[model samples]
Target: MNISAIDLTIFVFYCLLIMFVGLFVSRTKKGTEKDSKDYFLAGRGLAWWAIGASIIASNISAEQFVGMSGSGYAIGLAMATYEWIAALGLIIVAKFFIPIFLEKKIFTMPQFLEERFDKRVKTVMAIFWLAVFIFINLTSILYLGALTIEKIMGFPMIFGIIGLAIFAGIYSIYGGLKAVALTDVIQVIFLVGGGLITTYIALNLLGEGDGAIQGFSNLYTKTQDKFHLILDKSHPGYKDLPGISVIIGGLWVANLYYWGCNQYIIQRALAAKSVEEAQKGMIFAGFIKLFIPLLVVIPGIAAFALEAPLSKSDEAYPWLLSNLLPVGVKGVAFAALTAAIVSSLASMMNSISTIFTLDIYKPYLRKKANETELVRTGRWASFVSLIIAIAIAPLLSGLDQAFQYIQEFTGFISPGALSIFLAGFFYKRATANGALLAAIGSFVFSGLLKYIQPELPWMDRMGIVFIFCCLTIVISALIEKKGVSEKSINITFDLFKTTKSFNIAACIIIIILAAFYTIWW
Candidate 1:
């Protein structure tokens, strides 16, 4: 809990670097969207590389740097399921969802639902998703950020949380999505670099212990139940992860909904300069995810070997950094860790502003608003959300199983949303009725599986619900008459130009990250 002078210097330098990057981006950012398209969707011209970097920055937060690593300490390799399984969804999104969203020129995922289904369905989904996004994202972020702050300077969790919110709000409100994207590129670099250093340091520390094979073997033996590839029905540890069945079957639906249909994550890709850039961004992120276990999970295993127990599991990652990282490098590591959290908060705040402005405000209240006015409104929205989130930060302080719970609770909407999107594209017969039905159906089923029969194989049960939801959509769509016409939609077709070079780089990175595990571990 005691942060040395070394830690303070490292954290401060990192903060200055992030502030520099955020300020630099704000200087050239143009507020003239010309319309909702430019301001909200970044003129539908985002290149794949920027989009890919943004994706990495958006998804890899303290959640990975802290929560995932903490999970690694407690539960071992089962935690890898979070990143590894997501590759399946990322591929589906790039291949299918991208083309559809581009064709629709849609600004929000809810818009696609409205186009494919109805306003009623879209509204239901939008409200649910927005609430889920605000709640889950902020809850996990606040806990992680607060812990990171606590690790640095004790006392005043409230002050620390507000400080982070204010800093995040600054870039998000002024620069909009561009600010978030630009900052993300820098944060991802620091995050990756910081994670690698910490991991390498841990690996060296492990080497000092019994030796690599003996050290890992000893760590594995103690944490064996946690590391087992298979899920145990009665294990108290996996309370956060879906049952094995969920991992195998239902998790795909959740990941697809998130990476593919979720407005917050996908909006970055939509901002790409072109389709190639967007694709490159996505494939690039896939590669980064491949390395997460090495940097995040394995370090947890190492921390366990060090018997580095903390009052909160989330503290494990930070504790490792505090103990293992040397003086000069520690500052960089702390900054990178904090940057990961800041990037995530900034990204979510910006995306929420876009949805509220374009999806909610423009559509209902200010339909005739000009680009400048809308941009101004977006700034206000971001600022307001920040204030609101800051106020709620203290209330979010007591989350148990924080990371796992965030993912689990969000499952209510994620699976349903995933089903709706998949149903929209693959099944021409999918009707508004079916779309509406699938959302309700998946919600009910996933909930019952999660809460009612607590002992049921949740992962598998959730997967079954997904299959049933798919069936319901297919059957209901077939029975209906009037359906959506893709022609009437003004979706952003030809959005991102897929990139071969980026894709190749992405693949090589994934291979390299995986090789890190196979060879080193």
Candidate 2:
């Protein structure tokens, strides 16, 4: 891969601009200092646009660029169900979930658990989340980002891993969520602009001097087998996608857990200026999610159509960037890839610190710690977590498909966590004991099912495990003989009402998704 001087200059300028914006926005008055609220929640002052941009920036990372592209190459358009279903999930979160979280003033997911259940449940889940974030989420992001650097830049993996950690840490550790969120606005601009450029180039190449539209037409003609939205049982990829289960089954568990309940993703909305702003931000994100597959997935399918000379599926994205793009455009596309990687790393680091400092350290280790002390502890936690992830990241090499690996591993926790939250919100009889049991049972049942039914698809396993978790909560509550716990949240119709504009936007999103599935199916 040959780099032009102009490309290098553009990449360097983009990096410098992001750092400057991050530091500039986070700078406070000369006499005042940042407290826990300012540092962790962006001073509770993020606007709708900032919230929307931050959510997409944080969510679309190396995983989508490198990992999901790999899945697209192997599994084709069926892989896009994750992105399409998530658009609907965001709407559900905005309409039903955000209001309760805002009304409760919830700063972290574990904090919500503490209020709804008990400290014991909160502590257990917080520790579980800490382990998952550091080991699975952070490590995978670092590994995939490093994979991209190694593939595109021809650098060694260790250099890429350490370099990205230092880059994300420079501003994110000191400036906190404020810096991370504000800088993401710029990152999204580069991300979308550069991503579209790469896709356009790939399409034009496929069309052989015809425009992108003709390129897509050629693609459909050549690889129509790769464009199905649903994979039937006979399909080679059915074990991963599992036919219609993608629509009416376990994918819902995955989407709701990731979009509505995950700490890092939901943290953006939680920091909004008001619940209205948060809801609007979520809807904005939903609209953006509608076309994300174009930026990430299509390039891989194009590579597959061209019969790219690749050793493995994960290399499809890097191969496209390296072989397809012209001189100056490569830098912009590279920066877009880097933007996705670093933003996600920064967001994950901030979230790891938030969970550890607030839910774990503040409650048990440092009950008397002041606000400044808590903020200091958070910064240290972020640094330490990054170091741990860097050390463990290289172990993820040789994975056939990194995106599927992440989804399957994270599924271990999503079922129980979603069950607990839904129970707390609607089922008044749910008790703290039941929440704890559901949390523990999620892992136990998933493991047992995997061992007992080794051939079952992971998606169906997740759906089955989710049902077991729901029953675990219910049975535990019935055994206790408590009618309704004192901590149960009182549900009201007013909590979920949406404005006319939001309703219209929601209808539009649903109609568009329906059209896509109908055409693809």
Candidate 3:
């Protein structure tokens, strides 16, 4: 697949615009120990619109563009679980977790752990989060985006990668979290708008071959099995991805941990001005989540209808672009893809740098460091992490499943962090020692099962491991009941106050969209 002069020019233009935005933000964006708070957490003062769009941009990456579309090719509509499950999880986070985070004014989730539990819990989480974010999450997105260019446009892998790393690092280094957040908003508009256009074109292509009715029938045939929510042992990996278990036992725990507890992902909400604003942002992201299938998954099915069996595993999305998009629209779509890749790269790089600077550097290196010094340190950290991520990116280029690899490595924290945080907040009797132990136990259990069983239901493996970790913490805390803080018995629930009308309205909208998703066609 040759990248035409026009597509290459368009892609380059988007990258330049991203750099321009980063440079623009760096001069205006504040930074210091006083501003360090702003650099890392967007001054803790983002409006809902910015927060909402940034959430979409930061969250959707080349993984979804390439990996998710690949899943659509294999599993059909079943892959939509990653997007939809988050809807339930975000509401839970918006209602339950955001309040606690904002109420405490926690700089990071690990900070919340230290506040509620102990320093040991915080330190352990920091190490786990940093490792997963750097090696697994950041590396995979960089790899997949680079690989997409390598396969689709005939560029060397290193070119797609260094270009991404240097570009993302430059802005992220200078502009900090505010730059990352604002850039994310712009990226998401490209991501969603470009994705919808692709979806529209692919579906329109279906009408050409067999006409609309026959095309719809062919589309159903390609994806019909994916709609069934039960395990079917007959097909390959069917057992690996049974819809009901995939959603219930599997995705539920994973999404809760991701959307609810992961610091890098949830910091967009943490950056919001008020709890109400944060809730609005998460709910808005939830609404956007519902539309993702229409963009990513539906297009993959449409590809099956028109251009069947896209070769070179990752070619699913690119093949559709070659066949579906018109010339000028291809340029816009390419920009959108660039925007998604760069935005995610910037978000991950920014978060990793934040953790290193605040969690590891300042406390251990120079406790008396001022805001100005910390800001400089963060810049250095971002540069170094980008280098490491760029190096690791090529390694993931040929992986069979990007999302699965990401989830596997990410389990090091999500299950463990969720358990520790829940225990700290709800189970007052939970001991810091027990929480730390739970973190270690959860990682070992999940990792061992995933590696050994390989064939065991991934979700149940994760769910059972999560339960084991929760039980360990709960029982240990109960045994240490004598040490529990009696005054902490109350929720100190000030964090949870939100306009009743907003939540009710959000729920009503969800029901309406969900009904349409189910009943339409």
lDDT value for model 3: 0.77
**Candidate 2: residue 169 lDDT (0-100):** 92
Top TM-score model: 2
**Ranking of predictions according to lDDT:** 2, 3, 1
TM-score of 1: 0.88
Using TM-score, rank the candidates from best to worst. 2, 3, 1
Candidate 2 lDDT over 1-521, as tens digits, reads 45678888888988899888888887989988899999999988999999999999999998999988888899899988999999999999999999999999888999999999999899989988999899999999999999988888888999999999999999999999999999999999889999999999999988888799899999989889989999988888898999899999999999999999999899998899998999999999999999899988888899999899989899999898888888889999999999999999999999999999999999889999999899999999999999999999999997978899899989999999999999999999999999999999999999999999989999999999999999999999889999988988889999899999999999999999999999998
* Superposed model 1: Cα runs more than 4 Å off: 28-35, 209-226, 238-247, 483-521
Comparing 2 with 3 on lDDT, the higher-scoring candidate is 2
Which lDDT value does model 1 have at 84?
A: 74
- Each candidate structure's TM-score, on Cα atoms with residue i matched to residue i, is 0.88, 0.99, 0.93
lDDT of 1 by residue, 1-521 (tens): 46678677767777777777776666653753345565566667766667877888788887887888777777777777767767545755775577667666677888878887788788788778768767778657866877777775574787778778877776666777766787788888888898888877776666656555565566666566666544565666644554564345666766877899888799987776655556666776787777777777888777877888678677788788767778778777877777788888888877777777767888789889887888888888777777767776677556544677677677777767877777776666677778788888877888777677776554555567778788888788667754654423333434334456755664665565455445433
lDDT of 3 by residue, 294-340 (tens): 77777766765565565544567877776567777887887777788
lDDT of each: 0.72, 0.93, 0.77
Score residue 261 of candidate 3 by CA lDDT: 85
Better of 1 and 3 by lDDT: 3
